[model samples]
Target: MSKNLSALSFRKGVEKNVFERMVDAADKAGTAEKNDIVHQMGQDHLFGDAITLGAVSFYDFLKKENEGKKVFLCNGSACLCAGTQDKLHHTLESHFKKEEIGHICCLGRCHEGGAFQYQGKNYSGQSDAAVADLVKTGKGDSEDRYAVVSHLQPAILTAEFPGIDAYYEPFKKLIANGDRDALGADLKDSGLRGRGGAGFPLHFKWASCRAASGPVKYIVCNADEGDPGAYIDKYLMEKQPHSVLLGMMVAGWYAGAETGILYIRAEYPDSITIVNEAIEDLRSAGLLGNDILGTGFNFMLKTIKGAGAYICGEETALLASIEGQRPEVRTRPPFPTIEGLFRKPTIVNNVETLANIRAILTLGGKGYAKIGTPQSTGPKLVSLDSWFVKPGIYEVAMGTPLQTIIDLAGGFKTKVKALQIGGPLGGIVPMSHVGKLTMDFESFKYGGFMKGHAGIVSIPESMPMIEYIQHLFQFTADESCGKCFPCRLGSTRGKELIAKARTDSGFKIDRELITDLLDTMEQTSLCALGGGVPLPIKNALQHFGEELKGYFAD
Candidate 1:
């Protein structure tokens, strides 16, 4: 392999503007390689990582941002749109404030790249910098767009402060509100599907759990994000953990759950410690467990270590593991709603699913529903990885085009051949189909894409198709629980077939045989891993068939 083949920087993709800016900056500095700069992004911007969902916000110190601007209350739970918009507002406030001008009427444009919203105005691509720059530099903020600065390093400046629990700075003056039920109503109206991969309607889940036939129900947060490229769940757990706690508490109250469990991946030690610490602090403060905020209802929460099996991500397997049994999946007929952990009805929501519940409880569902695509409401947070530019967990209103998602990631780092939509079991979207794609379950599933969990892994043109499939199959085969026949035996057989596909020997390989095996797995496998294990291999064989046709051409 050439030195370039091993180049991580070659995988560097970005928003064109961010790419140009970083490239120009790195060139002038001439101090480091591009990959080094890329890796250091989370540190530089104080974005801890993908799983933290949020990190320390410097907007607290920026003079312009804190001024008369209404605080949207940023946190990991609020995600990019909230964070990016706040930053844009801050930038505008900073720009306008630099001139020492008190012009609140029309503060130029939102320079940091968010659409500005007030009772009377709609400012897109307008920031305080735009207004201030117009006044001071006498020019409009010419920057066409903005992208999340991915090359920034993990920040410790805020963490260094005395005991910060939330990823953002500790805010006091607990803003008071009236009638929290109205807040829940607004969220229900917002049409916000849970940001969790299920895309299950948030309101329906809460209402169903509430109506479940039981005196004691449970609300479990599935934080075991074992996905290869997915790390958004860990982000909220470690950084803005309080948001998760608050969301869970709200979900418990709304769903009438008496107990809650956070099933975290035992592998994520950092997340475990952070979450535990926050829980301990909250307990001591009497903000949890019972009589929360003095609302007559009581709910208790506990954290359990997951066995790290992929199937454990399925709710039934999670409940079994929590019960101290081998982490194997159970059929979802009685479902969690009918027979769950300890045989009680349960509401199993994702970490991201519950993370935004607090906002809905406080803001109301209707207001929340206005954000995204029609079928899929609210902001969807996808963890962008590998081939995309500006890739990270981005929260946007539903129906945001797939191209827009890639654009947000800074476009392609390599020549785009296809995209793997939903992690291991996801669909491979072609370059031509990028524009036709929408970020929703129905649209994705109809296209043979499964939203298994919100993991977006891209495949570039230069990548070795065969090797990628081999690596992915190895993961599926190894992770199989071995309880069921098809998953266990089928995965083993699948791997063997793939190995044979790699070697021509003396005769033509049976393409039909391989396709038939894939079909059987899709139809009869026990779970998602078993079912979708054929995706990577099948896609590779179908698209790169010509390359394999010359297997004996040597």
Candidate 2:
């Protein structure tokens, strides 16, 4: 019999496969089965029970509260703005007990509200009849729906999805030529910035990883698309899986990495299934695995379904999660490109960023660079939320005017008060500024906003500014990884302040105190989750000050 483990033996890091095993154990466990599984995992991995439990606790889906839940309603910002979660909740409660119901942050079904997950499948349009049908027949009539549009003359990211035969051509040609230098040079010349929130130059990360000293390097595709209204990654993973895979393959080839991991979120069940299928298709086509296309170069790919921790979207935290550690943000300097994923050099790119790789290689760096602005090169995917008449994903040049994209989405369904572009962490844009702003990073930054993930969650005239602020704080408080006090405690405090102001009309928020709090959270927080939440709140205070007048004291 194995002795009770007292501490972690693997100082370097746990094996990468341990995370998937833990997730599998959690998924298969019942309410009473957790302790036994935890103990077993401890024995199997030689981790202390406390450490194992701590890692397991980071993911909300692995918690005991959700053990018996039959359905999960999306409490994402888009769904909240649509005002459908309550109705969906009530309908779900009629079938499953309140204890049997749970909530997930976002389902990437922001194009339609009333999104819910049932038995590892996602469904939207949660009408009463739909809920009833779901409960009775184990399936619902409402199918997932969204439009795909491209404004570019020759669509890049939004181009028609290709089959296996066509998918491997670019990669095969790349292998035959064996011009890794040209590949890197082309990426640099193309001026491609990461489509992920940071907008860092893609080539810099690739080059850094390539130059980093390590025996084993990793290419991690961040498919944890936790941004509430952003389904761009989801669309790419589902519709253009090959493009994403090809991108990773290119990165593997260029970076001299042999393995790639696609860290897809558990909320996106369909995306997980589709991407897994796509990986198998690639493996069969001689595009993946040992001796690829009969060349000496070998590349293998696998997927890890994130266990519902939004902070795992952060690269360091994501690396930790994959290593069977707590998904807390690690301080940078020894960045992921230097020491990541088992303390080896790792290139972590988001789904959209990886998806853009094939296009860049095919078009040549200069040619691809010509598609968008000089600063923000390449096509970007914008996710217009449910408020739009034509709510879906659109591919447009980076410098396209915000108003033009809005028009492409068929405008709002109702008179909008403001728009929350990017994710929850991005700045809130007032309706008046929409026409003045452009889609590029520089433009949005100039306008005191971020084009993060380019997801537009519209706040209608009906929703109170105070309520929206509360939502922001609540989201931050819940999603915070608790590694930094500024984010962990600050988010809770911010939420409480707003809640107090909302309930007690006589209770006025001290502006100085709030400002100091925001300043601290922004200045000292370890990662963007804490640092970035203040952007939207600060934007609200600056732009929607009048709407939030009574809540604050001068």
Candidate 3:
């Protein structure tokens, strides 16, 4: 009976594993309170009930209240900025019971203010007809609403997007040549940094995994893109899935690994379905399974849908989630490349980083390097929020002017005072500083900002700066993994402090107290979740002090 339950827990049409049973069980039962199934999973996996529950309880989607919900509203930064979530919620309530509606962080529909999930499909709630049709007949309208274009002369990421064929040509050529060393060399020459905000060199990680001695190695693509305004990864995975898969296959070949895992967010149901289809297509084309293309190279790719934890976007937490453990941040030095998934050498690259692999190979290292600046090479994909006149994904050279990007997006729809470049952890750039910045790692870093995920969320002139700060703290508090005190406690405390000040006009926020708090979190937090949250907060305090006056005590 236990074996049957365990077997049943594994999702169909994907490789089998023990860790995913808890997610599958919770998904099937619509609640994590299935004690019998939890016990079975614990017993089969050789773990305790507490560990199983911890794993199940880590995701926001598995909450008991969210169970069996037919609608989910987007409270992401884009939606928040547009002030459409409340109206969307009210509209959804008119159609279904209030209990039937839930909330999600982001749905990669930042271009459209009203983003929601209905019956496991993403839809923009911006249109009343679309929502009415969905509520009435289950099937809504289907049209290509978002724009995806490249400003470069020769596009890299979006070149083959909206079309998925012949992406394996570079991989086939690599197999024919059998020069694995050149793969590493080209990546190094291309100077491709991680697009996932850390800006780490891609070749260094690939080389580290290649050099590590392990009988079993793994290549993981971090498709858990939790950044609220960011959907570049989603665009690539949904439209050009072959590009993502081919990149993973290339990494597997170079790093001497046979297995690859793509961890996509549960919010992105379309990405999961499309990637799964693409993997099956690869197998059919004789490009995926053992002894591929008449060569001895063997690679198998599968997808793991995230249970909706933002911290899982972090590589170590992602690894933990895949291992069926609590998705807490693990201490490093034993970096992922050294000791990763299943205690083997693992190469975890961002979705955009992996998507760039095909481009690097096709253009050659030096040729690809010539597109962007000296330090920041290759073109990058940037996502613009709904405030823009034309909000969508645009691929631009790495060092393109920030103003140029805004202009390309058709500028703001209304008067905008500031821009929140990157995600929650990124700096809050006042409109005056827009001309001083460019779209590169060094440029943003030099300007006291982070080019993280390159998703720009506009702050309207009407919204108070204090309110924005409050949102950041609240986001961090809600998403903290609770492993360390600094993040778990600090984020909550920060949110409360901001709340108190906002509610009580006479309440003066002690600058010293907040400064000390930020310093402690920045210095002592276990991971970026705790540490990086201070950046945007500090940027606000520094850049928008006049706007935030009368709230501070010091």
Candidate 4:
């Protein structure tokens, strides 16, 4: 009885996996012994499920053996154009296996390409020879890079570090005044929607989490900026780490959370390093940890490095990953604000979203509101691909014309066919419609597009839209978590249909059939990746339908 009991001691009513359950059990029974017990349980069928136990032990062993054992560089569209993947292979081919020498999606360092992540730190701008030399001698130069090309007020992307006081002082003033409620109210008044793809209002998330009843709560900075062309969150984390950390700290105070986490994707090692350093600075300055700012508001900040899963960008999936579970998007009704991160009322804000908090608090909501349009207030960061003459991170007013923003990036170096205003899942707007669009939530939403991470990828007149659509479907299919059928099957089928449409002139893609699949995915999938996969495809069909007439018999 004691032996069996020792093998199973996870908390009741808590959703945890077998490994997590084993880890909790091992707190008393010892790790090695518990592992053995779990393995033996699988053979003995002591637990109700033998297959589950076997699977858990198998994965646990594999996870431990392979942790931090490989390196991957961005194979994303922006990085591919920059030739990062080839350069990575040229550098690390001899040192690592073909499996190890792999490609990743955009590291959000689109402008400063030639990027590769080793262990957990990102290195960029190194030549192939230089990367090889670094592999041999353990010395190389890699750093974060950004540019401010806009004349508008820059709240998030403005890089002038005014010391710790600059970020914390505004919130410190608010805290001292004992107006805890004002923090969220100010955010609401500012109309600062999340800079993440969804563009959900930030204040409402904070207010709900604050109002929720929980003994333990969390404020998570979702720095997992996985969108291919989007690097704003990456830029913010790398260049303005303190601002993001300070924002999380402010969120922590408002949501009544003692613990804050910066969940950064594994691709941006530079971001991870910078954010961790910023947290240490906060701790050293007595800004984090117990009794912050002599105000008795205790807060702790930690950084969790992601395993480069795109689905983990979803808040629920992120929380699941932090809890050592498979990163699958969970159903939401009990949203993250109400029940998240171990069933505690948690608020997850992206790096870009949180970066706005300190500025909002300082500027006052109304002041901040006056920066951009009424619906999409304040400054927004735009990450442009290499096709742009001056491709870099640009901060622009939210409602700025798309043409104006493109002009800021030195216009197109080539004849632009279409533009993906967001990431891959964002709309594919033809050049004809560029004049009609504005770089804001309302405008993009009205145009059946998303202002997703505000990363703009240019589609040259030379690159076929069908090929690009294929790439989108392929990416979605590859990254689908397979937790739901709609996204899982739809993305795969969509990719196959697109591939066929490209190769076989007779292979007519039934538009209605494709629409049904897309609608099913959009209406029923677990998260945005599944639902949002069809947006770009739909947009492509809308603008380029005449061009695609060659593939289908009309």
> How do the residues 1-554 of candidate 4 rate in per-residue lDDT, one tens digit apiece?
31232133223212332434444443334231345655654334334344333323332112333333466667676665454566566667778876555567766767766777675557777776776777787766665656656556444557588888666777677656758766667888999988887888888888899999977888888887688888888777877788788788788888789988887776776777788888888778778778767788998887766655787788887776565445677777889898787667899988888887777877889999998899889888888887788888888888889998788878877787888877877888888988888889888888877778888877777777777778888888878878899989999998898888888777888877888888898889888998887888888888898887676546
Taken over the whole model, the C-alpha lDDT of each candidate is: 0.55, 0.86, 0.85, 0.74
Candidate 2 residue 281 C-alpha distance from true site, Å: 1.0
Measured with C-alpha atoms, the lDDT of residue 378 in candidate 2 is 86
TM-score of each: 0.65, 0.96, 0.95, 0.86
Off by over 4 Å in 4: 1-71, 80-97, 112-114, 118-128, 131-138, 153-156
Which 10-residue span in candidate 1 carries the lowest summed lDDT? 51-60
Compared with the true structure, what per-residue lDDT tens digits does model 2 show for residues 179-265? 988888999999989888889999899999999986788899999959999999989999889888889989988898998999999
- lDDT (10s digit) by residue, model 1, range 1-554: 11121122123311111123332333344322234443454334332233111111111111123234331211111122112445654665554444322212111121122433332222344445454545464445332232223211222111122343332121111212334465456656877675555577776667766777878677888886566545567556765577677667666766677677787764454567778898888778666666555656676777765533566677777665454334467765767777676557777878777666544543456655555566776555566654455655666545777777777677865676766666566666667777877878777767655565565666666555665665566666766766677778777776676576677466444667667777887788777778877765666666666655643232
Candidate 3 local lDDT, 50-88, one digit each (tens): 777777777877656657777888888888988888888
Least well predicted 10-residue stretch by lDDT in candidate 3: 5-14
Model 4 poorest ten-residue lDDT run: 5-14
lDDT of 4 at 166: 66
Question: What clash count does candidate 2 reach?
Answer: 0
- Pairs of residues at least 3 apart in sequence or in different chains that clash in candidate 4: 75-104
Residue 444 Cα positional deviation in candidate 4, in Å, after optimal superposition:
0.9
Error of 3 at 267 (Å): 0.5
Off by over 4 Å in 2: 1-16, 31-33
